[model samples]
Target: MTLEEQKEIQQLKQWLMQSQHQAVISGCNDILRRTREDMRVSQHILKEVLYLKAVAYRLLADVNSAIETLNELISYFPDYARAFQELGYCYLASDRKRAAHSFYQATRFNPALLTAWLQLEKMYKADNQSQALALCQQQIAFLTSLPRALLGATDLMHEGQLHKAEQVCRQFLASNEHHPEAMMLLAEIGIQLKVYSDAEFLLESCVTLYPDNDRAAAAYQNLLSKLGKFPDAVSVAKKRLQYAPESFTVKVGLAHALVGVGELEQAIDIYRELLSENEDRPAVWVALGHALKAKGDTREAVNAYERAIVFADDFGDAYWSLANTKTYRFSDELLAKMILLVDAEATKLDDEIHICFALGKGFEDSADPTRAFAYYERGNRRKKRTLQFDIAKTEKALQAQQQAFTKGCFNKTQGCQAADPIFIVGLPRAGSTLLEQILASHSQVDGTMELHDILGIASSLSHQATPYPLNVSALSNETLSKLGEQYLRQTRAYRQGAPFFIDKMPNNFIHIGLIKKILPNAKIIDARRNPMDCCFSGFKQLFGEGQEFSYSLNDIGRYYNAYEKLMDHWHSVLPGEILTVQHEEVLDDLEAQVKRILAFCGLTFEEACLAFHKTKRVIKTPSSEQVRQPIYKTGMGQWKPFESYLDELKDVLPARS
Candidate 1:
């Protein structure tokens, strides 16, 4: 409060941050001794010195030394709440969760110590439990007891009960304007809830108040990146890098921004550098793989993916990445290893979707569709979409796309290169894996498992500055043609020189428009299954990949609905461009349906398509294991298995559509 005291504080900060850390430590010790001898040493002064020591040790990564310092500080003054909080973190650094919790609770009685609860929240999150109410309650509850309503409301914002938190924030701000912390909290929460405009506003307001906080810089950068403002994200990352160049998280964010701006080489270089610095970090390796894959280095990308998993096991991401890279030797050995992993963990684990799905792909690649189908069914059962709705909509889309496609009244000529992959869309447990096997058996067709490649492109494009279909008028026909040409070029690597390549990505049903503009000649296949089964199947499966929407029942149902609506809209706009297939119909008359599909593709009906059951092709979808055997007459109209659990999804399903 006084000039002299402020001067002393400034001098202390400088002394603590001097060029020589040992010199700074010695200076701090001398100051403390002098202050104590003069009877001028305060509890605050002691705490500050201890805090500096703890921080220095932490920076050096001497966890034991940090713990000792923090422990000594707490023992010297057990009544100081911050001491307990810091000591708790030290305990946590040493993996003594219970001890850390004890100290955190001790600090709870002294509400000024925010780190106590914040660290507790981190501990909970690392263990993977949601704890908004428990950890975030500190600052909000503290502010609520104070005179500043704005600060109180702001505290609640980051605790994550968003709507209520915002109401508190607005109400507080209405009484007294320009409360910076409150505004920052509101902005931070807005970003979390995907309200970009509000977040930008609050973040801007916070910057005007506290311009030097690295945390604020990172937060703003993240918000900008998510909003598809890559340039802005890059700018902020540069500022943060200036402040903390060795910050790995910040480097990762910067790398992501570079990648977004199509600076593949630069991003790759940055990631490779970061990987070298943090050699064992899985994320750096993962990012390297992403960059390499985007740049079209499939083999190196696969190696990077494998290295990532090797460094960090239990990472389901590597499996998904490996499957997508398609660089490894697809052999029985890979499948057996995956199977062993799953089998070894079967008794200990309640779910095996990760292992089962990956192993199933191996079997499918081996042309053991029967075995592939079994694994797929196993994984799908874990997913819960059992054939009902998958079969129904699959049939409906099949008929609709087929009829429209047969009309063949296009205004333009058919000279453009189109993606003619057969897609099997529906809920996971739907008979898509079986359908893929049958279709892949055709001589002219190459059946790859459900590749989410097209969907990834569409999703990534949606995150672009000018999202397609959103600003359709902004795109000229030439641009559209260019986009299509680019799509063809990108997929050329996977062309396999086949007349048709099956793009069995189920989610492609959601992006039929992007598919149409790029590949006017591409065939869209919509696979449908029962709603109850679909949702149930989704709930049971553990994807650990891009199906972020599949983790919850409602999210999965809503996602399916969105996909269906989009498919229907695409069909209306581009009649005869898509082909829909029903799992049930295919099962009933495999030869007839296969013959009709072949005819549509301009190929004569091959008896091999009829004997698709006898064809041995790798069936890589979750249905891989199931399709290896003969077509089963069962699995159609089977809602009994999930009837009790289908209540939440009953209205979500299409009724007789």
Candidate 2:
């Protein structure tokens, strides 16, 4: 909001506080009218104005107007907990049940709303709801137990004032350094700020100092999973499970970690056992479907996904999972139902996003490009709002890598010379997984899921004063070799017995120099695709995590350009150290490209590589189903159908030859 607008809001708040109800309502309406068409007005400002207006109306005994204003505020900002709380007050006299429901929803979005909890406690007591009253009392007790500063920090965090929240948390932690809850709160703030290493350290310390604290353990485990440290996540999950042997949530979490570590059979067994006890959980069914799909059981996966929708018709991830299979066809009835759910007011933003993408795929399959592009754009736009992607930061990082890793730097040091790791790196949706599949088909190669060890190493180095890429040049030769050995040891859990294993972390393209510095003999394959195809494919995909740039066409285009520039720098600094594999070329002649990849990897020709489609292995990534079948030409030129809607992307991308 502008300075003038902020001043106006402040004045309105003062009026409301001074009991000038009419003046407050008039001021709010005036502000709203002036800024109704102003795109510069932030959602936060608008929400504040509307909430003030509602409070003023309630104080003036204009309950209907108050309710109307609160509903309007909620329509724009669905998760506005304060608006719901105000609505509860507006309805308390006329409809006690609805008042209680509104208060319940207020606490649901934000558990720190002490007033809502107190009100719920009274209503639950009056209604003789023993279970709800007990829960309400517990929440009230917890909130009352927290220090004033911590409570303020919790409120600030919930209100999206993350920096303020961080300040308050740090202040509280300054004197009480070992306070677990304070550490957890700071860790949460760190996670929001994308400081994963710091968050990990805080949570790890919290859990270590207080191993019995379930919340601390769970947060640590979740952060580990977010950082793609699945083995560590598995350990944490197992620890939690030991603490709460019958806790379904902990068991489900453990199963998810198991899936991440490629223990598909164990994850599947756990899902089945959980489902046998309770067959109505839609999320569990979806989890089961993912494991089944990864294990190469497409039909059973489809059945599981269908069962999730059967149990909860509005479960959007289940529908998206079915579409993600790339083989399941949504029937007319199901498609209609999905349309209704996507348009429904009660459908959550998370669900709406999944449904939008799913609908895009569904329409694309039906050959309705116009409808497909519409849903794709809707999903991308919605997803983009929830992310923070700065292309300039990406460009600067890539440039730093270029400057740090000059040819002279590599000549100064010798690496570990580990030939076991063959890294397939590039932008996602660029056929790296396909390359991994073909290579893993060879008798000598093991295909691991997109391994995170290299990224973890980079993250650890990022905590140093100089940080990674820049700091890489300062490492001694012995340290480099030790780092290389560390990587192999860390990734060992994902490997079986093959002499060579593939780490198909596409984002590893950013760390080519680090890869070379550590493991000089590790083969790096740059998976290339047509710029238009790759960017569009990425734009359409809803990755589980860490591809924030893909949600916007301009961001994705700039990212691809930066990636190309960085890859060129890697090639220049370390000549012949990396190989480029074009996805289209592979499509044109699978056998020849397969042979070329094998030759580059120093592997002999193998018939199994030719028959990669028949290889039965657990596959992750969106292209799992596609790679499991014979090579097809349909995926090529897919962007052409949506060409008209890609002007923003085209403007940012270099002109194609």
lDDT of 1 by residue, 1-657 (tens): 246545655665675576345654565666567667865555546666776667666555666887777767754543445545555655664556654555555444354345565666566666765664455565546544554554445434432246777888778778757666666667776765545566776776666567777667777787666554566677788877887888888888889877654467888898888877767888778778777765556578788988987886555556655654433445566566567666552211222555555555556556565665466556644443211123334345334433333223332333245556555665566666666666677778877545544544444444457653354334556765676665555444444577777766665665555555556677656666665555655554455334655544555666676656656666676767666776677878877888767766677777776666566543333443345557776555444444444544565664721
- The lDDT leader among the candidates is 2
Each prediction's TM-score against the native?
0.44, 0.89
- Identify the candidate with maximal TM-score: 2
Full-model lDDT for every candidate: 0.59, 0.89
| Residue-level lDDT for 190 in candidate 1 | 72
lDDT for 10 in candidate 1 is 61
- What would the per-residue lDDT of candidate 2 be over residues 178-275, giving only the tens digit for each residue? 89889999999888877778899999999999999999999999888887789999999999999999999999999999999999999999999999
Off by over 4 Å in 2: 1-16, 19-109, 116-138
Shift of residue 141 alpha carbon in model 1, Å: 33
